[model samples]
Target: MTVYKTYTIGVTITGAANGIGPILQNNLGDDLFIPAITTGLTSFTFSTPVLDGAAYSVTQRIRAKAPSQDCSSITPVSGTVNGADVTVSITCVLSTVVPKFAFVTNSAADTVSAFNIDGVSGNLTAATPTPTTASGAVPSAVFVDPTGQFAYVTNKDANSVTVYGINPDSGVLTVIDADGATADFQPSIATGYAPMSIAVHPSGKFAYVANELNLAGGNSISAYSINITSGALTAIDADGATDGNQASIATGVEPYAITIDPLGKFAYVANYASYNVSAYTIDQITGALTPVADSPFAAGSNTHSIVIDPTGKYAYAANGGGDISAYSIGGAGALTQIVCANGVLTTCSGSNYVAGSAPRSIAVDPYTGLYAYVANSGGGVSAFGIDPATGALSAIDADAATPGDNLTIAAGSVPISINVDPSGQFVYVANLFSDNISVYSIGVGGALTPLPTLSLSTGSGPTSVTTTQ
Candidate 1:
């Protein structure tokens, strides 16, 4: 028999822009038979008290009669509430409107997008663009500052970083610093080589970038000191350092992905070339990194992705070689291979087994930490039930269950990445070859049920997908 634990969920909605408060009032009013409306200037009140775990939905409608320059703009909506003693808030902000990729500053396709997220319905409404002082760039990653006052973006092709001041009440963004603004701080030329990823420290004092360095002679990670007031980035110590076994902690061959652990004590990199993973201890005070003993541990062949569990107790790598590797993180930030019960390391400990096929991305459900989804370039995804105590994976249902139309036909082509929403209710896959995204509803048994497929514009080539909360 299996033992299951029950949990309660609580939700609060705030910062409703684009007439979200009125829309939410209407939706919840119909669903719960309660009248709700916007009271004071920007405040929303409920006629009936909301209870914990109660289901609700929100919708926003706005109309601007202006024909030309007399435009109208609605603010981004945000949700904040307590769930299981944890405070979680989701905000929407607007940046540039780019086509073909999963790039959207807030949900808006225009310069300004409304910020509205319904905690009950789990739906989003896109707002019109409202440009501020900030200009547009091809943004690759978005990092919100710890104080929630600002956010930064990595412009890969532009070779620059964009900074914006965040509006707390509306969750909208105004450009604080635009492109080519070098007086604020610039990344070292070497480290700025096609910057692919960015991470902000918990303290909001420092930021890190993973440079893909698509060019001939430059590839490395860079660090920057963030200006809390201006939201600018200034190059920090050892601006551009190669991943070497001696000087810098060497990842396998081509370092494509990087993530810092939850505790902010260690950082891990997935090396695409060396087909391995590198672990490093982070200097909490200085934000410098030193390789751990036995640092570049072997993973499956062509290891391209790594993610730490929410608890910071386990580290997982998705290998292009078609297998997922699980490692037990020691107290000292060292990684020890978690072997199978039979004393072997590379064997299926779970029910859903993945044969050798390029597994490109891995996403773990933050709520349970008991399941993970791996997107394979070959087509399907392998779902693994996690052993929370030992960090081992076992198959849950069966191998690669097709979600939608693919159930009768062949699988979609080359799904590159997978992301589970913060609510842990949906899982999304970015299909590189198909140029589409597949959304699935997660079942209580940790299984995936497919929903309608959403098509992306031609040549969008979405390499990554992240949801803001």
Candidate 2:
């Protein structure tokens, strides 16, 4: 005897109508019409047991008889059956609704571009009045805060950090005054000679800027306290005095980029001329920085960019010599080099991953924490898989080349910066020479499939790229 079980589904219709009915369908092409009720809740049962590891969708009828009439819509709230009992929730309403956005920074054009994100396809459409001008010059880096309420741009040429209030729904940018614009404070705010990179703490309470040029005493990291209410910034006092010099933490020569861990407990600066990464323990109370043990960790030549995995366990540096330096983050925020041994991370010779030509920037996929991607300034992009437990990088075959060098794919000419979207669904690369943004869809096992049709045209010298979707 083939005994079958039953699954019970309950429907709750908001704004329940008097004389309307909704239909429910299963994968087997069977429809069940649920009668309207004066009360909001009703229950229906199906006699067939659901197969394990199989997906079954129960859709609701959304048709209306007359325009603007009281027609109820149906939706699957929950549906599952187990043991001797079955339970599910099917929701219905008159109608339901929603929206999304993306942003791009153009360095040469001195502007920022906004786009509307298509939820289904992840495609971008230019927003009205596209390419908003930057308030400062040579905007080298842009950071949209975690709250998605504010944006910070570091203008290398102007030696200033520009603040902007973000539109939550439309992804628009409007400059905010950080120097006594909202509240009266001591002197106006400013950055170093060439602020090359900017990073906001996860707590949304501090912002760090890397001053890349050699000013008299200006080659340092600037610290600022964020005004959460107004989305403004105020310089932190280095000595905890109002009259003392503004907070400036000195680093190796020509620091090019900075990154803070997701935990907000540590920060790192990649020094281009110094060939090292400066590590620091963040002062949570004052936003000041203190050097960690073995302060400056040695890296390859022309260290350009640094990134920490979402797990907070490993850190990587993209060097100009076509290789990536791997490090194991210590408890006190110190970095220890991770030497690769026979495709695994171990204490061995050569503590780096050979990458594409002139690797400039790198990003770790936040979803699996198992992959890292680098943008090669010489030409294309490179991919590597991270050993989660050991923090060593294993080369992922570009197509299926087993036991080969690091996998490389032609993305664009002179790809400078690369970043993964928040959803971990797509990767964007800013090609300096090509003057366009290349879009790639992330696939299983960390493969990148280029969506050539979706390549977005940008202003000249799109040196940096970031997203706030």
Model 2 has a clash total of: 0
lDDT of 1 by residue, 156-264 (tens): 6655556666665445566665323376533322235655556676445567766665453224566666655566766655212333322122344566677777556
lDDT score at residue 429, model 1, on the 0-100 scale: 68
Q: What is the C-alpha RMSD of each candidate to the true structure, in Å?
A: 15.3, 15.4
Give the Cα RMSD of candidate 1.
15.3
lDDT for residue 462 in candidate 2, whole number 0-100 = 78
lDDT tens digits, residue span 1-469, model 2: 9755544433344333432344455553344544343336656654454654344555543321111113332444434444444445643333321125555667778776666665545566776664465557777888877557888888788788888877776677777776644456322258877899999976677899999987754568888888766778878753232345666878899999999986678999999999999998887778888888788999999999999986678999999987899998998999999886655321223667788889899998754567888999998888888888998887775433234443687777789999877556677788887778887777777777777543577777777877754
* TM-score leader: 2
- Where is model 2 poorest over a 10-residue stretch in terms of lDDT? 61-70
Candidate 1 ranges beyond 4 A from true positions: 1-118, 121-127, 130-152, 164-175, 178-190, 214-217, 238-251, 340-356, 398-413, 456-459
Cand. 2 TM to true fold: 0.74
Clashing pairs in 2: none
lDDT of 2: 0.72
